[model samples]
Target: MPSLVPPVLPGGALSGREQPTLYADGALTLRPFRPADAPAVALAFTDPAIQRWHTHAMASADEAVAWINQWRVHWAAERAASWAVTDADDALVGRVGLREINLFDGVAEVAYWVLPEARGRGVVVRATEALARWSFEELGLHRLTLRHSTLNQPSCRAAEKAGFALEGVERSALLHTDGWHDMHLHARLTDLA
Candidate 1:
């Protein structure tokens, strides 16, 4: 086993099975999202559940390509990275991202969503753990934050399953299409990760 991300800190427990650019457990793979993921990502984002739960913006096919291109730009800039989640058969089922990355400080926010067909399969949980383990072990992040719209119970459950503790709620702080809503805050330190 080796470091999954970068700057593998001294004494970190990195797995030799995980590659520097990506990591996988069982059928799930977490790797840098490429332009090839656009089609699958587009289809998943258009899912109504994803729209209602995650507020995915309406986008045309070309827009999806543009969005994916931005992900690549970020990857090149070392500001952030997105990973496409796949199943045992290597079918794209979801996406996860580590956004607002501050590598020098070892902090990041985890974001993820699974397609309708992928939900209830624990895909998000597995993807999250893979990324978190990389952040804690390879990147040496001290903490990770997860925020879920108060209305999203499933996300809250997923956060808990990923070892996050509810810190509190940001009351009516999140502006939505309908109105303002609370956002539940979840945090986990590297030690817990």
Candidate 2:
């Protein structure tokens, strides 16, 4: 039986084309992950801040390579899309992406992390804004959500700076090594009006 509402976006919306490299204010680049970035990715997972908030660590470059490869698979499956955030020299500064994509609903969740060296420079916020624009304008997504542990002030600020409005909090929505954390939910719609 068919539902009453039609799909918000057609099928093959993302899988039909190559993921494009995105530029942010000429200062940052968002590109598909490459195997060569494994070392930098592996090193980034070692940072205590990244490990704490994300709750997972890459044990080796080999592991990071596998993780990088999965992003391509996710794109092909149309379930998620991720990009490596880089600086002007193409140095890996962090990562950003949309996950849990629901084409019928035109919705996805935004996620990102910044290298320790790139933290204070607003890299994540810039990347998030760029990715949001692409998702709304290019991918035709109607809404994008971003969630973070309530204890993660930096992430909360980045979400707001990227135009994601605070919606509410989820009680004990995510579990970390330390314990379960309350998550702050933020959302951005394609049209604010």
Candidate 3:
């Protein structure tokens, strides 16, 4: 009989890094989403900016809970890592995560969004920077990429501020409610030189 257990990484998990309970830097903290955050999560999706980019309008708290639950599955499967961005008061401010993670290739895509009230407060930028650093220093990722609609200037700025250089634009890369949209790609390498 063949063994069913898969090999684990140095941390005894497939992710190859310790999943810390919290990541904080002064005013911002990144922690796993909890069930209590459902109302906030549902409300966030109602914002015009979130709707325009995310394209998923969460209609109820139940839907938000389901989404939150899925994040745990993603983390366990080593497919992605998501964190709830919180402020000094522990209020949910935004979210940041690594998606499309290809551990074998040491590459992952970073994604984030700030709640309407959190916009212009540098929450996204700070969270992204912290996550990128963790990806490189802790997860041993060689590269991290971020992509956003070419029309999302704030996203572009966040990526830039996190040290991700603009790579190029892909036309019609994603289909949204308004039809195909061009995407701007940016990337950062563990070794800048």
Q: Pick the candidate with the highest lDDT.
A: 2
Q: Tens digit of lDDT per residue, candidate 1, span 38-74?
A: 7787787788878776776647667777888787667
Candidate 1: regions farther than 4 A off: 1-21
Against the true structure, candidate 1 reaches a TM-score of: 0.84
lDDT of each: 0.77, 0.94, 0.84
Error of 1 at 130 (Å): 0.5
Q: Give the range where candidate 2 is weakest over 10 consecutive residues by summed lDDT.
A: 184-193
lDDT order of candidates, top first: 2, 3, 1
Per-residue lDDT of model 2, residues 105-132, tens digit only: 9999999999999888889889998999
lDDT of 1: 0.77
Model 3 poorest 10 in a row by lDDT = 6-15
Give candidate 3 regions above 4 Å deviation. Answer: 1-18, 22-24
Least well predicted 10-residue stretch by lDDT in candidate 1: 10-19
lDDT, residue 173, candidate 1? 75
In model 2, state the lDDT of residue 122: 87
lDDT of 3: 0.84
Clashes of each: 5, 0, 0
* Candidate 1 clashing pairs, residues 3+ apart or interchain: 1-15, 1-16, 1-17, 2-15, 2-16
